[model samples]
Target chain A: MKLGFLVDLNLCMGCKGCEVACKVENEVPLSSWRLRVKYIDIGTFPDSSRNFTPLRCNHCENAPCERICPVSALHYLENGIVNVDSARCIGCAGCMMACPYGAIYMDPETNTADKCTYCAHRIESGMMPACVVACPVEANIFGDIEDDSSYISRYIMEHQGGVQVRKPEKHTNPKHFYVGGGNQTLNPLAHQRIEGYGLFNNITHLKHVGDPHHGILDRFLAPFAAHKAVDNKSFMDFEQKKADSHDKSHENEGGH
Target chain B: MVEHGINATNAVVTMDAALPGIIWGWMITLNMWAKSIGTGVVLISAFLLYRHKKESMPSIRWIMPLISFVALNVFLLFTLVDLHQPLRMVNIFFHPHWTSAITVGAWMASLFTGLITLLLAIGLLDAYPDCARHNEIAKTVRANSELYEKFYPFVVFLAIPVTLYTAVIMAESSARELWQAPTELMQMLLAAFMAGSAALVMVSDKWSQEVRKDLALVLAMAVFFSFVMYMGEYFFSFKSAEAEVTLEYVHSGGEYNVQFWMAMVLGFIAPFFLAVSTMKSDNKTILRFAAILALIGLYLAKDVWLKIPQMLPLS
Candidate 1:
């Protein structure tokens, strides 16, 4: 049975308990983490409210990362857990740009990339992923999608499942099934920085748009940019305008 | 007062598109700074080479250490851009989406760093041109000197693009105005070539006054062209809504104002003066200082250009 994680944003209280639990359980370096809680503070000051959503890897069906590594450092196990073999990673930082979700980060200790693995270590030992286990709000749901008895499966079937996926049309089919009204639709621009631990405490977004032609030029530059390999997977969906339009409506609708 | 509200609203809409552009433009800043260092190194080398032309090539045994030390500072500059987890720097690789500028920049920087490191090692062991004939570090360096000659050009070429990649990434982004230059690629190319020539001249030995003057004149001309191109791009970005917001931010004297001024003086004006001063006296020191100033200013401009555009997005 293929494993997967279903994060019901509706239940996530922005408590960051999952963020804390993931760190302590993983012995993650004090400065970084595998899982993070992100909040989007929309509207101007005073009228603005915080929109919190716990974020992690979706164990993408069409994983962009596995396609780009110069060496086969990251792999998706048969059970469908996305994992990294640290020995193979060369500290290249190639995969960070491939992920639309900004889910992965380079581990400073090993100088290799690190992101949520659905807790393969704990899962093999018969324990749930740390975030799933420590989720005081029970907002995170993890299980095998194929088995009808699996909670995630039952949950997906019972409720209208949504997700914070890349423009599925862009081809990275994120398996992180989102619940209704969670993540005011998927918008990376609105994805602000996680606060606390020094510097700006507000949930700020990225520095300004560095490349306006990103939606186009990035694709053109990809082949010529670097030596990183690419998987010629068919990306059946890539409508930047559509995603942008949908994002506009989604944010206008207020907190999901 | 009215503009602030307009800016805040606009920021909300384009935030997604702009963030990556900002991240990638940083590489451009580093490229600029590195070039500045390169200019200083070249001018100094040029002066020394000119003075000691008749003597055996004076051993710049100290160059190896200086390169390493300067490189260390350059390394730290890249590390300064992070927010939450600086150690997770490699995450850029594990999550590769080819479209992400930061990811692409990370790869370029890694490759560039690797090459620089190898060059450093080769230089340290003193293994350039004559290793095969004499079997000594110095001889190897002399024998393999050809190898380094080849290596230098290639690295120069790669470094140049990596330098411009920053600006190109910026020029295309909808986020910041300064980056959207219609002529950015060409502008950067002109600057890199001019700087490259200056670097070569400063570091080369056995050259004549006529040769030095010719190279200096060419570089000055290149600087003039680059300035024109940049001005054009600067104004081009100011005509749009998103771009205009960013353009206004630059004029607002955000954190980058002083940096921009420094770049103008050091990168453009100072070198111009230094190069011109050589016409008055045959002194090498003034020329060296000019070369250093020009290089520093070029880097300053690159950094300010990349970073200042970013400060405008509402917090």
Candidate 2:
């Protein structure tokens, strides 16, 4: 009984209903996400398209988080859902390092590691995940992938070779699948990221807040080498120059 | 203000970013650095005891466990403080999961500390039996030289695992391609040797010149191999794209460029030269200075190595 999740990129309209539903159902705190929609723009201007990729835990068959966890806080249920026992978690963040997909987050309130469980709580009560129920276009398909008659299993069959999973080379064997999204949409490195564009723009330091050595570390490292914050100018400047040149080429062509 | 919407001109507008900032930070770096010293001292002291029994036995017995005990405590303290749920650490021992490197490391480290504590007691009692003249157990332990010998080997054996287990934990980390288990394990071993020898150099004031030369040689060899491993990885990390990307943090003009080079020069280059010089000159001051620099540089190198891989966006 392998539970799975499938997102049809073609059907998703970036409504953000599922994102809201997940937070509400799970009571996720601010600045954290159990599930998220990534908006990646593909191609150049005049031929560009936007892809809404709903990202969440893959609940891998060989989950690294489950293995790296010091206390078995992350364990696989009989139904294949990777569940978390916050009570048992020592909050080592070892799971955070082990999860390739970046699905896990340190819950600010509980001070424990947390992530998408495919809504195991609801599933046990015989209810679908809130994201599935909230999605207006029915883009989210959830069911037993092992059961041939299941909707998710049938969807996988229909899509066949077209289905894609992120970072398959990592060999996590993610249960989450995507249909109709190309490499540009699935691969984060394939696209250009602008500074000050996303959540907490230019605030990559938010990650440091969780460290006990936050302020002291800054002071301690200050004398040694004085490493600057991540150089956003390197990549962002290159991207902006390319975009400007692209616009110039388009204008020159139009003038002709 | 550029919002979460696509501009059609730009390549992407990532609406929701899941970039967890440096999950493990300086505390973790300190943990590894201290552990290396703790384990390295035991390993080196054991070798010295076996090889230079006459010169090293009296001092090394008490000093080795004492140094290790202090450093190991610092390692354990930071490890606890770094955890978001420090109180639940007992779950590691109470509800033991043998698979997790962290759980295994915790148990091994605890047992290692315990053994070191026992060794310290025995060494102190053996060296100064008058301190515990009234205590029967202390007197009994002081007389039992065979028991001390038996326990010493166990501490030596346990030190290797306690030092190497962190590499397994790092290697097991998902998507962190930089921390390959084999390479990391090798690096950890080298770090132990480097740290152990450097630490012994600091306390070898009462030891013979030959023993000092031996410690210097060990420091030089460890530094040489450790430097070679770092350079190899830095130059040849292109085999894996993820590893290449992670190495970008230390590449020329990259974020950690200056610090990485600083670590190389201080930890390996200077130490190597000074250690080699001490072999011929028998200069205690230069040897001690080299040891100090090596320890400091090791901490910096570890800090950079740990922080760089995490800087790469996992999302």
Candidate 3:
């Protein structure tokens, strides 16, 4: 039925309710998350604006993770939900490298790759995803986009040309769509200056802990970590200009 | 350099951005290393066997098969240990994914191992004709030397594919530009030959002048290929910002600068000179040292090649 998510950025309040709800419902470890809210700050002080984008698995049509998986541990269901068969997983982590969205996480507990299953178990029981139900602003919409009568289908039709999918250039043909002003938050490369504060600070921990050469070994292996010096300033500036032009064109198309 | 400061003060914050880390770690690297050595030994031995009617090098004739067999087993062992569900490896045979390079590689490795083991048994039977009188399989193999000789070429053909499969696994990862580069397979092939030849020369005590010359030629080709691949990757500018950053990290005295330079100098430059010099002198120790250096350098090169690509944040 091609079940998908349509996150409306206009209504989101950066409350982080979905993030917490997802964690509680999934029983995800404190060190990892199935979903997260990205905060993007645009412009300077007085002219500044903020955008909150909910990030999760795109459940792509051309799933690279599924293709790259050596043991066929990551597979797609009939409804198009890409799910990981933990029992079959070899913990090779090939899927983690293949996923362009960074949706998958290596669960050290299970020693297997894990990610959002679109709450497939809950959906099979005829319940909405926990994140959608708990979203205070009702910003997280989930339904069968293929079904014309579904809310997601109507929402997509209503938004029409305004819908945005992150990294469309990746050609994953992501099922997750964002409506309204999510340009800044959707493009990860667009974040000019990132402050590792709040939940974002965990990114640093993730980088360290996820590293194969962390702990005592890092003393000897630290020099090989030089690729960490990614100069994204110029790239971010370019992306910011591109996003601005996109916003300008949308503004010309009339207000949301 | 892009400053990744911890203080949030006034900037945007991404809670779940992609982090830098190795997805496939040392286990995969070791597996590839062992597989290359195993395959290369058999490949070179097969070349020698086809060209020379008699056993020109008595030591290499018996040693090469034994080494190839042991190395192949090591490759298999590492691969199994790396799996989360080691028992589930059999699932690949039952539920094969034809599209997956890893699936093909697994099958290729299995076939290569089986063929090499059989070939080793045949070689052992031939060497100790008295042992063949006792065992039926050994007797059949020893009696059917002509048949085994005919199949040697086919085994050699399988060895090349099995060796290249290691490289193809990395190159198939479309998400990592550093791996997906067209020259990755070529680089890997060259390195494998270099490593394999170096290892062969290190263990073999007595070899004919022609055998030494052949090994020298192989080492030279390896160095030449490395130069071409490195220049192509290092000199050419990448279109993608992420790719450019990754290439810069590899070449621009970044974190892996020491390892990279070490690989170039020790693995390629030094070995090239040592191998070339062997043509004028019959110094076995020089060749052995060169082989040891090349082996170490190739491993370092692979370590850099595998680790840096993963360190680049994909999301």
Q: What DockQ does each listed candidate score? A: 0.06, 0.32, 0.22
- For each candidate, report what fraction of the true interface contacts it reproduces: 0.06, 0.65, 0.43
* First chain TM-score for all predictions: 0.70, 0.79, 0.78
Q: Is candidate 2 or candidate 3 better by DockQ?
A: 2
The digit string of per-residue lDDT tens for model 1 on A181-225 reads 432334443333333422234323433221111222332333356
DockQ of 3: 0.22
Clashes of each: 56, 2, 1
Candidate 2 lands at a TM-score of: 0.89
Pairwise TM-score winner, candidates 2 and 3? 2
Q: Model 3: how far is A152 from its true place, Å?
A: 2.0
Q: What's the lDDT for all of these models?
A: 0.56, 0.84, 0.73
Tell me the deviation in Å of residue B106 in model 3: 0.9
- Mind giving the per-residue lDDT tens digits that candidate 2 earns over B138-218? 777777756768888888999999999999999999678888889899999999999999888888998988889899999
Judge candidate 2 against the unseen true structure and give its global Cα lDDT, from 0 to 1: 0.84
Among these predicted structures, which one has the highest DockQ?
Answer: 2
Query: Model 3 over residues B144-191: C-alpha lDDT tens digits?
Result: 776556767787888877888766767557667666545777776776
* Residue clash pairs of candidate 3: A90-B84
Ranking of predictions according to TM-score: 2, 3, 1
What candidate 2 keeps of the native contacts, as a fraction, is 0.65
